[model samples]
Target: MRAVLLTMAALAALGLTGAVAVVALGLYNVSAVAGHLPGVSWVLHTTFRNSVWLRAPSEEEVPELDDAELIALGAGHYATACVPCHGAPGQEASATMQAMVPEPPQIEEAVAHWEANELFWIVENGIKMTGMPGWPAEGRDDEVWAVVAYLVSVQGEVAPELELQTGGSEPEEYCASCHGEVGGQVPRLDLLSAEYLEAQLQAYRSGKRPSGIMAQAVTSVPEERLSELATHFAETADEAGDAPVASAELVVKGEALAREGTRDVPTCLACHGEREDGRRKGPVLDGQRRGFLEVQLTLWRDGVYAYDPLMHAAARDLSNEDIEALAAYFARR
Candidate 1:
């Protein structure tokens, strides 16, 4: 009886091994043209869902809901970073995106499966089998989070200001009309802060940021003009909050968190503004909105906001509580 049982078990093992080898050796068609078999598709989908869930980190901390200014900042970043690939509320992905394999998933359906951390990680590291490329500033987690905050705002009744900035002109001449002209439709020199403008220019110059049209536009400008252009935009004194307002309570709570982080996290001002000799290398976060703030914090925590190394480090340090509080506090401004 024991021998018979052993023999049966051995036969079962051999059968399974042979089946595995057959699949591994490409005995089955694995082409998109063929599509997955019903059972295979189910298995793959289920596995993906479960994997995302299992790998995602959970936190008891909830994001603060009152950040209106931060959300606005996020909008600008989003308009710059994500819109080209994911599209906005009324916009669609670029024609090139449609041709990508496995295509960029619509943000509406895609953001749900990811935790804040997972999102950040994916943005920073990028997905291996997908079209998603890691942010150009591979280490810039702060920017990644900011963009995530913007993504959340894009979902709602976004204000018109969040609209893309445009200049009606021939491709090469378009940016010039606004970027260089005095009293141009856009703000002129001395309107923008040096750091803010410089970063954008560098992103373009280094190919860290993508923009076929803008890339061409910047190439002709002298290095000094590029710096001049950034100063022009940053000095414009644009008040951050253009998005919808959030709650006062949320903003207050967010402020508290930003000013004084919890055990595992550092308060933002420790490096951001309050520091006598400002340790933070990234942008200042005063007068941002809650909606924009929340999305960015979520992204930073998730590891997606990529632009600069300092930004990445700042974001990587954020706990969910800090993210919520920082966003809310900034939003109230």
Candidate 2:
């Protein structure tokens, strides 16, 4: 027993000595230019792969990725946040970025190795020791998924140019690509309050709200033009036949929920409905797209928006059915 203890002590002392010597004598190479040795590189790569595989959410947790609108939203964000580090189809990363040690891989080739869940994990929580940054909006997994959705769609194909139109101040042309020339898949911006529109834009810019698409979109608009863009969209009327057709039962349920509110949930009209004082705390929900409303309500319930505690509280108890009903009710208006 004594011999075994002595041998263990000797090994521990030897290990400590080597560590101390390396630090005291500066034996380790700390320079980025020196780069990782082949063995070290393999270890890191292996560790990263295993870590992502273990930590990634299950496939069931991931939302549908095949939607064209969702993919476009992801593309819009990728064009700004990712294109500089990892080039898109037809676009090459800059020389400086390419010079990075263990350079960012072209996502097209990289996506083939990872599943949708793994991609979401990486985008939401970036890899360490790599130049990757996690999504800026902390709880906005929806936005992260959008990026993942786009990546999945464009994996083998040449990425289309999603650059925001700059030069002029008009938002209509810039927004038309995704939101549609007359508001199709996306929510009708015209029905939204200018205040609500501007607030959301500012939130995206400040990273208070997590949206790679919105963050990039707001950055393209100069500070002076923000209000103008908001007002432009806010005043425009929704085009005829733009409203989605919801089932009568769903619409009835939604109307009741919006007007009456559940025992635990407050009436949507309490804040969104017209007030005698002309005071409003929430954005006008009427005429907004069902999908957009459902997405926003889900985010609120998930505590993504810290700016609005009331929304978080109101949406906290809402179920999927409740959200669908409310969305249907508002879309009909």
Candidate 3:
């Protein structure tokens, strides 16, 4: 028995040594340029597919979400959140989006494959290694379920003139607080994409994105504004100086860093520019809000945004200086 144990230990040690050697020698290609080996791809694909199946609740007792209500809420949420990465009819995921290593899959084609519970799980908990972000703030299971219903039912040709589908109007206070014209107009609602606008409101409603003020403010706003607000914003583009404008000095510094990374960082243009259709592994930064950028960076720094390993790795390396500089630069562009 002792002889057998000794042999087993020896084999284990050999395996460990071989594994360490592979790492030490940098045998694994970490480059986005390199394609995943078929076997490696299969393992990852299967694991994701099966893990969703295993984790999702088997019973079909999801809370009652009205089909019409689900579609309405889902539209709002998708407009704000999903459209940035996944896109919608009459909108395309940016050229840069095409280059994501695994790529954010188009939802219409892909979402149908997932069961409602599985979809809920993915939205609530988020898929690891992929860029799919979990609900932003957490603890709103009901809202998460609402989004799941929307995605499952959403399909084919968003009507351009669809009136706000829900029943009531937004509370006067909430509209005035953000968009009363005389209000600081901090949200830049005018320039927002309709799809983008709806998604954000839904996130706030669902507690997917962190916004205490938004939650409190919009919670009382009737569901109709979810669509009305989104549609209104969608129709209006850059109604004022809503686009980000970094200070000249900050812009200079950020532009240099973004277009040409210094000794430590990589250039944004290299991965995101015309050469690659902005489709490389990095997400497209064009036209995204400065406020949103700041929030995401903050999430990255704090280790809360766990949607993708690449983001974690990138954020881990960024210093406060980098974050401020990049935020300022992207905001201006």
Top TM-score hit: 2
- How many clashing pairs per prediction, in order? 50, 0, 15
> In candidate 1, residue 245 scores what lDDT?
58
Model 3: CA > 4 A from native:
1-7, 89-93, 155-333
Per-prediction TM-score to the true structure, in the order listed = 0.46, 0.84, 0.47
CA RMSD of all predictions: 9.7, 3.5, 19.4
Off by over 4 Å in 2: 1-4, 20-26, 156-161, 164-186, 206-225, 235-244, 262-266, 275-281
> Which stretch of 10 consecutive residues in model 1 shows the poorest summed lDDT?
180-189
Q: List, residue by residue over 106-202, the lDDT tens digit for candidate 1.
A: 6655665556555655555565556566665544444455555545554444532444535443322334333433120122334335876677667
**With candidate 2 superimposed using the best TM-score fit, by how many Å does residue 63's alpha carbon deviate from the native?**
2.4
Off by over 4 Å in 1: 1-44, 92-99, 112-124, 138-140, 154-162, 165-225, 234-333
Cα lDDT of model 3 by residue, 1-333, tens digit:
999999999999999998998899988787766868779878988999899889887656675544443345445556545666776644556776687767777767657577778888888788887777777555455457656766766543332211222235445433543342221113455545566667777877876665533564467567776887678655654432233366788767767767755455456666544453424445445555554465566666566655555555556666667776777776666
Give each model's whole-structure lDDT.
Answer: 0.54, 0.77, 0.61
Lowest-lDDT window of 10 residues in candidate 2?
176-185
lDDT computed for candidate 3: 0.61
Looking at candidate 3, the ten consecutive residues that score lowest on lDDT are 157-166
